[model samples]
Structure formats: C-alpha cells, structure tokens
Target: MPQRERKLRGHFSTPPLLVEQVLDACGYTPDKDLSGIRVLDPACGSGNFLAAASRRLLSYGKQVGLSARTLARYTHHNIWGFDPDPIACMLAELQMHATFNSCYPRSQALHRLHIHQADGLAFPWQQCKHVDLFLANPPYLAAKNNDLSGYRSTHLRGQVDSYLLFLNMALQVVRPGGWIGLVLPDPVLARSNATQERQRLLAETTIHHIWHLADVFAAYVGAVVIIAQKTPPHTHHQINWRRERWIDAVPAQAADKVSLPLQMVTTVSQDLLSQQPGAELRYLLSTIKGTIIERLQRQLHMQGNSQTPRTLACLGEYVLIRRGEELGKESALLKSSAPQPNELKWYPVLRGGIDIHPYAIPTASCWIAREQIVKPLDRYLAPKILLVKSAGRLQATLDTQGHVVLQTLYMLQLSANPTSQPETQALFSAEDELYFLMALLNSRILQDYLYALHTAYKWVQPQIEQHVLAQLPVPAQAAYTEKEQIIDRAKLLMHACSKSSSVVELKAQSYELYEEQERAICALYEIALQQRRVPDPPHDVVDEGVSLYG
Candidate 1:
C-alpha cells in the first residue's frame, strides 16, 4: 500500500518502540555503516520504522565521531519509505525532515528522504536493488472482502503470503544477505497446509529471530515479528527448532523495553527433501491398493471367520442422536438425573473436528440410553464405545461412563484394546488399532486435507456429513502396526510438551518428536494411499508406556 493511501485510510503507524525492538532483534548497531544502507518500509505508515532508522543512523554517526552535518546528510540519503497513502507519505516526509533538522539545523546539502505513494504489491522494485533492510508491518486485510479465495489465487500459488510477496518484492530490491523483518500472525509459523510457500521461504531465507509479541499485539493476537536474512534459493536443509521468543531477548538495560505477555512460541524448520526419506514409509502405506477396513475383512476371511461377525448399522440401531442446537442450556451435563424408571443414563460425549483450543474434549452434552435396551454390540463391549461428537467446533475421543448416546458432534467409530480381559470377546484388531486410528486422524496431512475440504464448502453452513467423513482415506491393516507406533510416540511427545516450563523449549522438543514420528506415519500412509504393500515395524517397540500425571 502507498503512503498516501495509508494516510487517507487512517491506518495507524506502528509505535516507534515496536520498530526499535524489531531492529534490535535484527542485530542493528548504532555504530554500523550508515552510508549507502537502503531501508524500505513497504507499508511505511507515517514512516515509523523509517524515522527510527534515521535516528539510529544519526546516533551511529555521532558514536563514530562524525560531524552533525555528516550525520544529517547520511540520514537523508539512507532512509526511505513507500506506502499507498499519499498523505501518509507526506507526513512521513515531514517526520523525516523534522528528524534531519534536529540533527543539522544549518546544513543545506542534506539529501531529502525518499517517500512514495505506490501500491507496493504492484510496484516496480527492481530499481531499488541493494536495499539493506526491509522493515514495516504490512496491512493485515484479507485480499478479497468476502472470502480468502482471492488470497489463495494471488498469493498462495506464488508460494508466498501477502507479507511474503512484499518480502519477495523487497528481496528483489535488496542485495543478497539483506535483512527482512515483519509482524505477522501465528498461522505462518506452524500452519501445515502452505507447503509450497513455506518451502520457498525456507529455501531462500534464514529466520534469525522471532519476537513472539502475543500480549503486546493483543488486538492482533498470536503475533510474531520474524527477522530473517535473505539468501539465494538453494537445496533444502535441515530446519532447526529455536525456542527463544522475541520477548525473552529484550532486557531492562535497553533504552526502551516494550514487554508483551508471554505467549506460546515455537519454531521449526527442516529440509523438505530430507523428510522424504523418512516419509517413504507413510507414502508407501497411503498408496496401498485396498481400504484398510476391507483388508482387515479379507484377513478375517483368511482366518475362516474365527470370531462372531457383525455388520455396522445405519447408526440408528446402537445410538440415539441429540444436536447441539437442541440444548437450551449454555452447557449441558453429561449426567442428567433419572427422569423415569428404567430410563437411560447420560454419559460424557465428545465432538469430532479440529478444535482451536488444544486438549479441549467436549464435555457439554446430555446423553441417554433407550428405554428397552437391546443387547450391546460385540464392538461396544471392549475398550468402551466412543461417543464421537460429529458436529460443532471440535472432534474428540469419548470414553464409556454409562449407557449414553452420542451427540451430533460425533463420529460413531469403534477403537479396540490389544489387552483384552478373559470375559472380553474378540473385537477384531490387526494390531495397535487404537493408535493407528489416532495417527490417521491427527496427522498434519489429514488436517490439511480436511481443512481444504472445509474451505471449499465455507459458503455452506458448518456441517460435516457422514458421507464426507466416510470418504476420508483409512490406512489398511498392513500399516496399522506402524501407524500405532507413530501415534504412541506422538502421544508421548504431547505429554512431555504439556509438562515443560518454557513454551519454546517444550514446542521445540515436541516438534522434533512429532517430525520423527509424523514422517514415518506419513510415509506409511502414503504407501497405503497408493495401494502398495507396506513393511512391518522394524522392531516390536509397541507402546513406550509413558505415563502422564494430571
């Protein structure tokens, strides 16, 4: 956006301290070279970063024993800004002039600061090559007013975000190894779906520091200021987990310390190519020829139907249904009182879907058993039947407490336990069935797939149908053992992460564990998806038996 347009629209300029903190994180030194250092603030609202840069240069010049006139001349020539708001550009120029006059009231040869009213997204940046630092927070508005479709078309396919596109423009204007910093939302850090864009940035840049300012940027919650060095695109490399948040780096000794509440911050970067080898297993598993359930059926046939077989019903037979909309209370109780003799008991219910709040299992529902109960299915007897909530904002795993029917926010699937009691009937399990199912549901790949599907029908009401849920690919029996192992490992990591004192350290360790296991799972799933055969786990590590307290 142009300076004039920004001003016309009254977009608030970033506070000066925010700019200073960002620059400091980028390793700015007051005594560094000031001459020929071109700085561009793409969304230079009122030129806050630009003005700060000028001041820093002046301080730097003074520290280096330069004359006032020399400092004034350097500031004018080095500092520059661009915004779509012409009025903003004019105000910025005024700010720049004022800053210069403070340095050299009598100097006549000071170069005027370059401020322009140009749409940065479409601007010709090639002329500004050799830019040293790209600074400023870009506008956060969606590309299209109605939906993110425009954003998908214009930015995502280019393997870039709006800010990233601006970064690309800046990179075009900068010399190799130049620095870039911007304030962005958390989605960019760990959101798994934007593979290509993440690949492009990771391939071409080095993220030096991330200032997680979730508290300070509360209006723009979950914000982080990313500091990166621009490098030429090259072969992928192993990504690192850096846990130090921007907030931690700030000190009491700095001239100005802007503190934000500690929010969870974690960073991970891995060689995209290197992951392929580990993911080979998942790939193989995903490509397998037949449905996992079907494969299990075949295995059952091979076993000569050793156990009693039962068909899954239309779902009405085993359970009753209650929609979230039916509840008049703010939140429903899982244990409602017995209203009549031989009435069904209510039990806890869980919904099925991604939840924004992690670890939030749905506890809001009133479930009841049928008045005249039919014999429980063979499948529901062991490991407890899950009252999987199919609708609402979250998806979860449910446990048996009583004769409860699932809410609309559920998936009526069954999970098995390997350790069956003497009274327990053979529920049928290839191996590690529970962990395998969890792995399929929790994989980043599956999350992305589901998210994309959700986005496609965003115009429609938020309703995920049984057909849609059924269509999701399930890995076959061959990979079930491997899938189980992966999920077990992931569960351990998650448990470990929850106990750590530092969000950064915990997430770092968590992701490392996640990456290792996820790749293996992905490779296995991939193989299954392709209808190819999969190898068994190299060893029988089974469950790690990591116990979680609280």
Candidate 2:
C-alpha cells in the first residue's frame, strides 16, 4: 500500500523509537560497519530504514574522526530503497535527502541516492543477490490484484499474502548468514496459507528473534517483527521471543521516553518449533502451561476395539462440519419480524455472532422463509450443534429446534454411521450424541485447547474455521456413568435456558451448574487441578498432597 493511502486510512507509520528497537533487535547499529552493510528496504515508503542506516553511519563516522559530509556520501552510496508508488518513491528520496542535510544544516535538496521508483519484487536479480540485510515493512495486502507469476510462492499456483512474496524475495536477495528483518501482520506466523513459507523459513534460515506488539498495532491488527539470519537453523539454535506493547507518554516527559514499553522475554529451541505440528509457531509457552497442554492431548486407552486402541479418539471421525452461508437477499427472505411465526412455516434466522450463547439461543427478530436460503436446508433443520465462529473462544449450543442459521455460526451434524466405532454407536442415540458432543465443545478444557492450539490466532478476525473445529480433541467417555453425567448436565442447562418464568434464579442456577460441568469434563481429560494447602492440626501450613502436574 502507498504511504499516502496508509495515512488517509489512519494506520500508523513507523515510529522513530520503533525503528531504533527494530534495528537493535536485528543487530543493526553503529557497532557494525555501515559501509559494508548494504541495507535494502524493498517496500520502503518514506524510507524509515534508509534513515536508520544513515544515523548509524554518522555515529560510526564520529567515532572514527570523519566529518558529517564524509558520512553523508557513505549514506548516499550504501542505502537502497524501492517502492511501486511514484508519489511514495519521491517522498522516500526526500527522506534520504533530509537525513544527509541534517548535519550539513543545508536547505538544498539532494538527489540520486541509489533509490528507485520500481517494484522491489521485480528488482534486478544482480543487485538483489548482493544485499546484506533486507529490512522493510511490506504491505499487508492480499495477492488478489497483482501478477504474482514471477514470485516463488505463486510460481506453483499457491495463493499467498503480498508480504509472503517479500519474504520469498528476501531469501534469494540476502547472502548466506546475512539477516532479514520484517514487520509483518501476525497471521504470517500461524495461518495455514503461510504454513509452507514457515516450513521453508526453518529449513532456510535461523529465526533469531521476534517482537510481539501486544495490540500496539490495534487488537484487530495484531502484528510482529521477525529477525532471522539467511543461514539454515542448526541443532540447539534457540529463538528469542519477546512481548512488547505501546504506552501513553506522560505530560511531563518527552513522548519518545514512553514509546517503547516494558518487555517480557522467552527462549525456545528452534528444533522444538520445527517439531511443532505444521510448524505453527506462537509465543513460547511456559513449562507449567506446556505440561498442562500435554496432558490435554495425551493418548489414553479407552474401552474400544483393538485397532489403534491406545490412541486418543479423533473428533473428526464423528461428525460432518458445515459452515453457514451468507443471506444477501434479506428482503426476499424476510417474512416477519416476529420469532418463528410458523403461520406460514417461516423460521427465525440467526445471522449474528452473538445470536447463540452457551447452551442457549436468543429470540430472533428476523424471520425468513426456509426455501429462500441458498445452502442445503436440511443441515440447519437437523439436530446439531451451533458454534459461534467469530468468537475469541468457542461458544456452542445444541439446537434441536430447527432455526434458519446464517454464516456467523458453524452447524455441526452428528454422523451416525453403522460402520463407526461400536462404542460410539451403542453409547449414543443421534440426539443424545449431539448433547454429548456439545458438552465437550462447550467445556473450558477444550476452549483452552482452541486458544493454545489455533483459534486465538492474533491476526485479522479470529474466526473458528471448519477444519479447526473438526480437529478438537474429544475424549471417548467409554464409561456409561460419565457419558450420562455430561448429557444430563447439558440437558439441565438447556432446559433451564428455554423457560421464561423466574428468569433470574434459573439463569444463575444454570451458570453455576455449567461451571461444575466444565470441571467434570476437565477431570475426564486429566487436566491439572490447582492444589491447595489444608492446615494440619499442630503443624505449619506446608505443602500437602499436591497434584502431580508440573
């Protein structure tokens, strides 16, 4: 995107303090030889990176007894910048000119500093092959309108983000052992579309460090700055990750003083990240959190047939997941504003993210004809689970009352095949199974799994995708007593939810029971319970029989 467009849209430009931090994090400073660095910002808009290089060169010159005029020539020779926007290109060149003239204290405009108004993605191969450090904040645009035929990720017909092409470009541009620093939207770290690029990154570079901008880029625009060496990751190489956010400046102090907030750091082995399923990297988890996660996913031998008897039963095998569709012809679909008037067989539609709460459904003000829906009507009419897709966590309810559901939710239909596991078939009827599955999906334990594993992806909208919901771990409650207990609790909550009389007391009772139900499901999954100390008769309040969890 052009800098002009970004300013018009109210998005942030690179802060000077942030530029300094990014430089330090990537080992780019006056401590290194600026003349030999050959820094390049492929997506430079107003040349923030080029200016950083200029500052470093001037600082280096001061230590070595060289004048600002001498260093201005060095800045003119070494830094390179490119942008597709001609207006942006002129501004970037002006930015470089301003940097050089700052110490000279001149009003003259400088020209011809190796900066070009061309697509960096299509920069000359000869020049790019010699770049030492590729540093830039590329556009967060999609590849929808561009001709990506020349890029590697798009060469094989793979659709990718525009920033991904910049990453691919960096690998070819930066020399071996050279560094690449990029400020990217957070999805680049964990999205499925970027899975191949991440795997390639581990195979081709030693990802040295990351800075998670904890909502400084807006909560919806979660972003991170990644620094890596072009060299392949070696065994025992660890990745440094830190959490940093923005803070408001005090009225008494300079604004720059509070621009960089306090940071929390963690280190994880590069091998561990490579080992993670699909190479999906996230903020490093602590030991206690890691241990708890391990237990949640640990394979347990439940009562079943001998084939893969020791494995934790897969959730994907039990149900067919269907994503709801968008209803654009609302005027045609609308029959009445009343809730399921039914006089003309019109059903109320749930089209909002907040339409369904845990174990409950709110009254719908919009009614629609079933025949007007574009998707297969049976999926919405069948006994299924309604999971809100656009939530930070899983919000689900079992829907036996056939409602016209829209794209904001996912409709889960329990697959009842005869060839399925005998225990699943014998233990559950079609509707009973929906309740059991609903209980699991709505549990606090699985909600924790969703966040730690996938759905809480900190970029864009964290909507629950169909594939992610299909992979949620569901314990095979082989014990008849346990299965019945979950279903009974879910039923009690649902029963309490449908009534209109004594709303206050019933809602309170339902929530209290819901929490207890979450606890029971947690126990079923062997999730660790917090330990407490009980006073011994005449002794100190010391450690008692605590849990065996880490």
Candidate 3:
C-alpha cells in the first residue's frame, strides 16, 4: 500500500498469529466440520484473516472425511470478505485461492472467492445477515476525519471512530448468538468520547473477553482484541478482562520455550461497569490492589458519625481550579515593552513545570509585561497553588506573590464563595488548611491512587483532572492540635527545601519530613501505614539455596 493512502485509511495489516488467536477465541478449530459456519471480515486487508480461515476450514474438512471437491466447495461458500480498496480485494481473492489450491489441487474454485471490493462500512446488511462470525481488523481513522455519515445511527454518536462504527455494523450483520472478534484501539473502553457507544455495546452484546495487546503494531499503536457474541437486547453477562505484554501469539521457537504470563485478569459484572459514567473499568487493576482500594474507601467512609458514610468531597467545592493563561507570542510580549517601576505590577512568568516543586517555586526565571497580560490578572495577584500539569509525579508549590504561570501549570485558589457551606469554609481557612491539603496531595497513598486511576500506559504522561482531584480523601475536620502539628512540620520542610544547596540533599530531607507528616495524617484518617519499604541488604551470597562455602 502507498504510505499516504495507508495513513489516510488507517490500514495496519493484522499479523497472521493474531488472526489465529482470534479464530481460536471464537472456538474455530480444524478438527470439526465448519460447512455451516459463515465468517465475514468487514475490513479484510489483503485477506490475511480469510486466508487463514480458509486453511483452517480445509483442515477441518479433511479431518471430517470430506473429499477435495467438497472441501473446495465449502471454502468458497463458507467464507466472505469485503474491503474498499480494489487492490486489497484482489489480493484477498488471490490469497484465498492459493490457500484452497494448496489443500485441494483437483478442485477449481478460484472464481468462487467471495471477497468483494466494497466499503464494509456501507455494505448492505440485509444481504449478509447470515454471518456466523464477524472478524476484522477495522480501519483506525477518527470519525471526524472520516466521513461516516452513511454509517451514522442512533447508537453511533459524538466524535466516533471508524473502528467503532464497524463494530456497530458487525453487531447488526452477525446472526443472533454469533461471534465478533475485532482489533480495536485500547481507548475504546475508557475514553470519555466513547462512553455512549460503549454503553450501547454492553447493553446489546455479551463481551466474552478483552485482550489488551500493548504495543502490538509495528507503528506502536496501543491495540486490544475484543471477542464478543451478538445477543438479544437487555442481555447481561460478566466480561473477562485480561492484560498482557506484547502477545507472542506466534511462537518464535518451540512452544515449551515461550513464557507468556497473564499479567492480569478479572471478571467484571455489567452492573459494576454501568455504575460509573465512564465505565472506568476497574477490572484493569490486579485483584489484590482492587480489594485494597475498596477497603480503603470503606474505612474512610466509616470515619464519620452519620449512619451513611461520608464520601470524599471533590476539591472543586473548596477551591477554584483553572489552567494558567496562555500569553501568545512570548518573545514579542517580552521584547515589546518594559515593565513599570512597581515590582508588584511586574510579575514573574513561570517558565514550566520544571520551575515548580513541592512546597517551593525554585526561581523567578522570567518576567511578563503587565500591559500584555490577559484576563484573570487578579488570579496572579493572590496566593494560590501552582500544579505542574504534565509531570510523572504530581508537583505543586504555593505562589504567595501570584506569579504569571504559563499554560503548563494549573492554578488552585480558595473558592470565592467558600462561605456558601460550612464544610467548604472549614477546609479553606488561611495558612494551616492549605499546608495540610498540600501535605495530603503529595502523600504516598494519594500518589498510588493517582497512578492507578490516571496512568494508562507507561509511555503516556499522567494528568490530574479537576474531578479526580475533588474525589481525593481528606479529613472532614482536623482537630486544632493535629492542624498545628501538620502546619509546623510542613513549614519546617518548606524552609529546609528552600535553604538546601544540593538537589540530592533537598530531596532526602523532604522525603524524611514528608514521611513523618504522612504518618500523622494517615493516623487521623484511620488509614493503615502501608508505605513501601526499601529492600534489606543480603548478608551472604547463596548459590542454589546453599552458601558458597557450604
């Protein structure tokens, strides 16, 4: 395929091994008669899947004692495929013919190949409703870029992806109780934009398994293989969600040499998935971690005296969270005019997340011209917390002078109407509250929770959303003694961090003080101390459970 055409159509060829895996998942084997089984690959690129399926069906026919002519007839009649690219359709037909000829030399069934040069998305469903298995590696183009107006339906809404539309099409064309195996982008399960389509899919089909195949493509596009069965409406069943490293679906050597461990797997109830709007898919977590997180939530709720456990209030209730303003053409703004004499009016512009650290802003690296400033200038005049929006670890610091933060940071200030509720007012009281909240935000527990919730893949940067921050658990009301002790420790740590001459020394001191403060806070919330421990040094070297000398 031409590079430009491939890019435009999202044409990534399916690996033969992955094709075999999908076939196995659908219970297709070479030892049984598959004459009645009708398989359709909607976006059959070069007929990779059809070619494989034809070989499997031929093997089955041989095992069932079918003659060469009967096997050839079955291959030509049982399998169908469609692709928009004429070249792809031609290649698919050739592949199927070659596979059948290898199995049955006397049979002349090349002309009966069902591969068609038709757009799968727009194919007439009424003509192909007898499909028993809808298997495909659909195009990955985003809906906005691809004109899917012809495939649009009530279930398909918002900025949909072309692959998602193909999934809906497959559901419609597959007969009741038939199977569907599709290679899809991993985000189809959790992205905010795909929530509606995901809901519809869950409501209509029984998803048997979801195999997350990370970095499976040569292009390194994160992909997943979803195997589901079309069923009557209102059907519900537990979905088996599994995760693994790049699937070595094809063994490089002997089968015994391969060690493909199941990284994680869990059965998820439909009711559980429906409870959250995003269908957040907590099954992705290991069973043990999931249980621990649930227990932690329950423990926090029981802290309150009310019969109904108190849920953690979102951070938005007590604080105004906003992304820093983007002052376009920074070079022009800085060079166009000089600042006035008043230092208060001439605020320093934060360069990026690197300039901010826990409880401290490293230096006044750059200055913004006051006249060129945009709206929310008042935000730059008050004390607020600056959060690094794109860091591996969450980095936040207090900006007492209200510096002009760049777009890379988020500004968090006490809400103007904090007095609207007693809880809000209590949480935002001056110096102590901010210090305590900052301590909790940077704690070990919250850090672990954030990683579980936000980190999708190791290569992807983790982000903090306003809604996620709001749900962070904090003490509903801190006692005066606890508040004073926390504020005092936080202040000391801030002072130590600012005065340190070496970054290494600063980090060591900060971590020590943070641990002390974390213990106190965790105690107040009745949370057990589960801080990760450094491994102890080995006393002696052991070889096969025996000391070297022994």
TM-score of each: 0.51, 0.84, 0.77
- lDDT per residue, candidate 3, 397-422, as tens digits? 67776678777787887776752242
Local distance difference test scores for all models: 0.48, 0.67, 0.66
**Number of clashes recorded per candidate:** 67, 0, 2
TM-score of 1: 0.51
Ranking by TM-score: 2, 3, 1
Which predicted model would earn the best lDDT? 2
Q: Please list the residue runs of candidate 3 whose C-alpha ends up more than 4 Å from where it truly belongs after superposition.
A: 1-8, 101-107, 126-128, 154-157, 218-221, 231-238, 247-262, 278-280, 285-292, 295-311, 326-373, 388-395, 419-432, 451-463, 491-506, 527-550
Per-residue lDDT for 1-550 in model 1, tens only? 6656543343545656567777876666575776667777878878878877887787777777888777766676667677877878888888887776777788665665678887666665557667788886776443333233443336435334455456456556666788887765444543333344455555567665555433333233345566777874333322222222234344423534554333443333233221331211011112222333334223323333345322211122222223232232223333354345555343332222322112222233334343322334323333332323433122333333332333344334342332222111133242234434444555565555444333222211235554445444444333335544665674465355432231212355566776776688666655543443322322421121100100
What lDDT tens digits, residue by residue, belong to model 2 across residues 1-550?
5656563432345656567667776677776666677888888877877777776776777777876556766776778898877877788777776666765666343445878888887755655577788888887766665556776447675678787888878887888888888887788777777887788888899998877675554325666788998888877676888766654334311422343454677776666566556677655433223344544443321123235433245566788877766864255666545743446767767765546777774446577765667787787778888888877688778777787787778888867652246354576678988888888887767777777667544645677777878766665434677778889998887766643331212466577787778777876665222221111222221111111111
Q: What lDDT would candidate 3 get against the real structure? A: 0.66
Off by over 4 Å in 1: 1-18, 101-111, 126-128, 144-161, 211-213, 232-550
Tell me the deviation in Å of residue 162 in model 2.
Answer: 1.3
- What would the TM-score be for candidate 3 when compared with the true structure? 0.77
